[model samples]
Target chain A: MTTNDFLPAAAPVARLIQALHKLPGVGAKTAQRLTYYLVRMPEEEARALAEAIIAVKEQIILCSLCQNLTEQDPCPICTDPTRDRTTICVLEEPLDVLAIERTRCYAGLYHVLHGVISPMNGIGAEELKIRELLMRLNGGTVQELVLATNPNLEGEATAMYIHRLVSPLVPKITRLARGLPVGGDLEYADLITLTRAFQGRQAL
Target chain B: MTKPRTINTEAIVLRAAELGEADRLLTLLTPAHGKLHATARGVRKTTSKLGGHLDLLTRSALTLSYGNQGTGLATVTGAEALDSFMSLKADLRALSKALYLGELADTFHPLEAPNPPAYTSFLEALQALESPADHDLVLRSFELRLLDLCGFLPQLARCVQCEEPVLPGGHFLSPAAGGVLCPACKPSYGDALPISVDALKVVRYLAANSLSSSLLVNVRLPLHRELAALMSSLLRYTLERELRSTAFLRAIAQQWPKAEDVPSRTA
Candidate 1:
């Protein structure tokens, strides 16, 4: 939704600019600049961009099992039997799956919560994929559930809540180990993370 | 060329929602500025220095530069976290209450309106919750004070319609009428919740007394129910809408039953 009627140029170009403005981080001026740039583009690139956006809207469906955005029903990872079916690493967003996948840390399946329970922003557990995750857990094949939500208040709250909801029904539930990031200055670290690192210290 | 207006305030991060690809829209409740929404650019990226200091429930001193036009969302140029309340990190119950306090403040206070009273109450409330104080009392006191400050202080001792003093016994609370109603006038309102005199006294005590002092009032379980119901209806009547945080908080309350036994630091 256009907030406070920010854009009012009335042309199709203005509509494009407003649409871009609605997106996160794109300021009004930047939105206009991008729109004008897109108008000047040699037709195929612009058509391709438009079609790609349309294709995502028309083709992408939430994976029935994991709730990750994909073109297929169960998504590739959920359908793969070779993957470690023993664990399910839960995340706050589809992007988080990519972030963890890049680390090549584990071969477990994934569950995307889509959003955290943040009431200040009107998000709740009912609005997320927690119920689907619970249904997935009911199959009993999953043993270890890793809560890998972002290290923020809402993320932590979501993790705690789901942990409460799923702990009784499952064998074990785990959270990503908190510690100092590599190459980080210890002095600059926030007290919370630093303290967590100390509390969960490891033997070298 | 004239420079744009810049505002500086010490504020707590009430809430943070994603604004754009890599930015956040923050609701900051400040002593002088009340609750203001500012845009922290590039905050979603780990490289963004401003991101860490703006975590939920963190209080920080901020310098916001209203962009050239001196309109729309202000840009957060500088931030220094005064306190991160790290104690709340592990305790999920405390975290929920802390978040509730933030959302409660955000809900009642208006944008850019200076409400030092509400701001002070909010900061104190956060500190109390972070202390893992009796959340029920903390929340009740905060709600009472918030109502008093926002000009929604419900009348306690008198009847809304008859203008007679309500005796110290079970009475009807007419939120629409903005106070307690004596039995004589109870039939005048379509919406009235039964509230005990003890509950009214507690609300009056909370309204008249400072939050820290009001926390000392030991409300029994039955009175607890009465006070909560009365205040919620009062809040809904005054705010004209249900506060979303209360529901979220209730969910957390159900999750952690032992939250009631959480030791108060002051106690």
Candidate 2:
């Protein structure tokens, strides 16, 4: 039996529970817990959370240049002068841009495709931001294109498709190296990962 | 209360979709259990042990556990890759064909029903795709085999209408009637497609031989197109909807050079 079978919540409370249940990982019980918590929360805090959500929806827009979510036209990364303008790292989502930025290892621009090419899901190259990426390379300023899509099958297919289309435009095209995880044990490594690590071995 | 049953089986990762934040819902095809929909928790995380093994189109050995009287979705507890088909995944054209095969197998085979022949045909097709053989021929042979296994094989030996022997001449294949219609019966079936004598012969040959034997028969461009269209029509009729991968296969086929045009290499 569900929580509602025990006691019927108020219309507003039930409505809130239904809305929360639509989220990615929230289930019926979790939604009810959140709903009851909201009922007990102070008005000021609840209003603040609601207003923050609205602000995010209203103010944020895709950056015209790199297609990353940003408040301004060209994101700060695209306009940053200290960053190398000769290289661009192509990624599958905006979150990936933040992941790479956290590393602080590479200083280059980024392009977000927003998704990978998955035929099973009815997603093709045309569905992604590929045409925009090609247009970005037409200026002839970029020299290296790094494909940082995930190492899964769909990601690899997307990278291959983009590489075939953009190879003539960019002088150097490279894909992210696949290997064993940093903290994982070598004995636990899968064969594919081990083979790739061997083939992509670096010289000391 | 009895404990949940744990079963180990070899499976092909046919389709996968995101579940919660870090989980993946996979559609796997197995020889013993047919198709299974299971959820792999934390598979999207970088440190996941099951992530690399459960990629789409990869065949792997899986350990699945069922609870609540086996009505709920199975949970994947362990996974190890058997054949990743690396070469096929590296080439876009071949990858498209392999995915189509996976989708076709997923469509024809029902869940919880043991179908070893269907499963074996799909595995063989994936293996054949990794070789330097003709990819289209492999697909044609797989389609015929799958259609036969599913009891949807088009009547090539005789006319579907009158049940008479199909003579050696131009005939029409009727997807609606589920077979070829002789010229005398073609006017009765409006949905029939014109099939040349050679095309009929090729289709018959594919149905009669194994996938490896089918690869030995070299087909020119026109006959290849005819067989593709005929098989596509039969599949569309059987499934009642065009598969998403069909369009991708056609789009990529147009971009690549014809198989006949590429000179064969001899040792």
Candidate 3:
């Protein structure tokens, strides 16, 4: 499977590098290095990488309400009737929703922002799916919005952005309680602490 | 996809995602780098030796084989436990806060990027969580510092628009524009929050001072409140979105009896 034996230097390996380099944060040097490595990789390993990429594209879709990636439209978390509906814990990414679920402390709905607000980065409110979140609040079923974005500058900005936008639309909008490390995410909290947070939820 | 580079570091296991039946996709934050994801083959099976050291927020030293061969994620070579925020496990509020911090750290820090300042800040925050110093202040300070380290520290020294210094006393922070604004400058932005002088001071303290310095030794509630307000505004301004963790934190705070509601510790 070595590239030396597989094809000319100008073949698919070159094409793959070009493609990989376009991804966020992947430098061209990294892309080329990876493409060369993949050239030498075993056939099965190469297929696996291709498969994972395809699997996400083919199988994953936004959970209807939470907008998180899921094979299902509503996602497991959103469909579970056992979960609390009045409170929706809002987060920045799909991974965050998963992180919270792992704790088993939260049995409520969620809303994923996909990205936080960064003015310097030129990401504004319109860039995010916040307006969609406001639509969720309009139904009047949700009573609280638990802002679970990360605790960084962007995370804080994103949370405050949503609070001002959604607070007027919803009955309550509360930020995550502050004992957690600042500039951190909600996805990494342990089960016991997450459980306590779930049990202790208060009105905004 | 680049060839995954083999790397070694001391890390804290933030969480594990079950992949298929035997493998686990592990998320970790290291002292050298920041947040990263790696696959641990067959670690979910009973015979796997890395189980104890790989739980949520458990610190460990790990060697990883680059993910270049497949999956672009790292594969764990070995792991050894350092110390666990075990107490956080028993206390729900504490644990939630820890997760919030860990998640924030994981999100902000990138894999394979060296962020010693972030690493140290996270380490100190976790340690502080164990002891329970004014948790709010600690969290706010950590946030302020993290933003500073990330180079997004909110501009407390001057107004975002006018470039004039933000005078002490009641001012406003414009989330739409990004940073504090003087009274004259406030009307230019629509979505600004009224920030008190105390809050501005806390913001300055958080943005200007280092955690290793004499900041946290003596924190006042007024400062905490101000920080909370400033942080809320600054973060909202910066991220341009809301965090679920902030809401969760506020929710938990509400359930706990006020200091006045609870009897004095010595009495």
Candidate 4:
């Protein structure tokens, strides 16, 4: 067939665009742009990108204890000796462990639930890494659970769900905090803060 | 040392945000109090002891030292969990719903109030969620009961304008006017949306009982729709706008298979 006759009828490109659009926060236009970008990328770069996708599925295994995606069956965080054995910080995703670590804070080990409890969305407590978390606590070395889920709705709910389930098993459970962002301005604060500011008023 | 306030109450973790370099703040829903904010000092530290005990959705018996701060904040002294709700985190659908409810609770309930009934209602809702039996009904019951506690009861048993006993028939829910309207009263109500008789039955049933009761498990789709409609109307009436989480809830509910019917592929 001639090159003109064999010209791509947008189907292959359209499929790529559709796939990109399905990703979190990627709109259709951005997906289209990304698809076009990929189509023009160097052959080596394209091969590398494709290989990376294959590699994740090929190499990534869940940490046996925490259920987090890891190259090793027992992730480095779970295996590290210096990490606290008496406490575990439960998170919704593996990336959250990274977020806490970025702050240069937290020496305790981690457990990734992979998700949170959400009844309206049809998720319950049984689908998470909670059973494994409980099992880890059974040894009695773990004394506390720190819920490091996101600050949003699902994050808070997941933390509470874990707390309720583990309260009887673990002696201590705690959550993250909220406040005015560092360097944030008073003029930009919303009612939640305006209320906090009023409630935490200072005496003249 | 003074004895810390050792209280036993079921709490919903509402929100968590980072504080100072090594501290975290939490909003909790207590069984004896509506909502409260507590501080976990040094919780962000590498060696902080309170880290795991402070996450969201964890129901715990807390030992709090009521801080004398001008803000009336409670400092978490000790914590022990009662249930982990592990099932919720494993499934995406359940996870989304739990988060949506947490958002709703955080939005509607005030932070400082000694509202024991509100606390109990929330606990019952969470427990109902721990299993697969009638989750939709549990949520609907919780919403209706919450509105009732907040002084926004739906006019389920009778017509809004005529005051006549509402019978099974074509009905419309008017959020602006507040409650359902019979066929005769629909036009006069100005903005009533269509509702089925079954929905009204569910609404009335939910409105009549405590959320913890078994009556919730009896609800089916028709009743589910009705309770949802009624709650939508009531919340719109009270808040004067729609909650952002309502859309998410609707989206998730659409993904759920019809009652007693599994997806063909799964089956």
lDDT of 2: 0.87
Which scores greater on lDDT, model 1 or model 4?
1
Candidate 3 per-residue lDDT over residues B1-267, each given as its tens digit: 554377778988765665756777888887666677888887654345565457667777788887456446688978766676656543445554676777667666767677887888888887777775666766777888888898777677898888998777768877676678888888888888888876777667766776655245566776667667767776766766766455545544564435333211100
Top DockQ: which candidate number? 2
For model 1, how does the per-residue alpha-carbon lDDT over A1-204 read when each residue is reduced to its tens digit?
353354455567777887898776788889889988999999999999999999999999999999999999989999998899989999998999999999998899999999898877667789999999999998888889999888778887788778877876678788887666676666656666667789789899
Ranking by lDDT: 2, 1, 3, 4
lDDT per residue (tens digit) for residues B1-267 in model 1? 443589888989988878768888888888987788899998777555677778999988899998666777888998877888876745667777777677778877888888998888887887787663566788899988888898888788788788888887768989888888888788889899888767777888888988789888888878887777877787787778877777776776675667544322110
Pairs in clash, predicted candidate 1: A24-B19, A24-B20, A24-B21, A25-B20
Candidate 1 positional error at B88, Å: 3.5
lDDT accuracy of residue B150 in candidate 4: 72
Q: A58-119 in candidate 4: lDDT tens per residue?
A: 99999898888899978988898998888788888888878888987788888898887554
Q: State how far residue B226 of model 1 sits from its true place (Å).
A: 1.5
Considering DockQ, where higher is better, how would the candidates rank from best to worst? 2, 1, 4, 3
Q: For every model in order, what is the number of clashing pairs?
A: 4, 0, 50, 60
Please compute the TM-score of chain B alone for each predicted structure, in the order given. Answer: 0.91, 0.93, 0.85, 0.82
Q: Highest lDDT, which number?
A: 2
Model number with the top TM-score: 2
Stretches of candidate 1 exceeding 4 Å from the true structure: A1-15, A18-21, B1-8, B63-74, B260-267
DockQ of 3: 0.03
Worst lDDT run of 10 residues, candidate 3 chain A, spans A178-187
Name the runs in model 2 displaced over 4 angstroms: A1-10, B1-4, B68-71, B258-267
Docking class of 1: acceptable
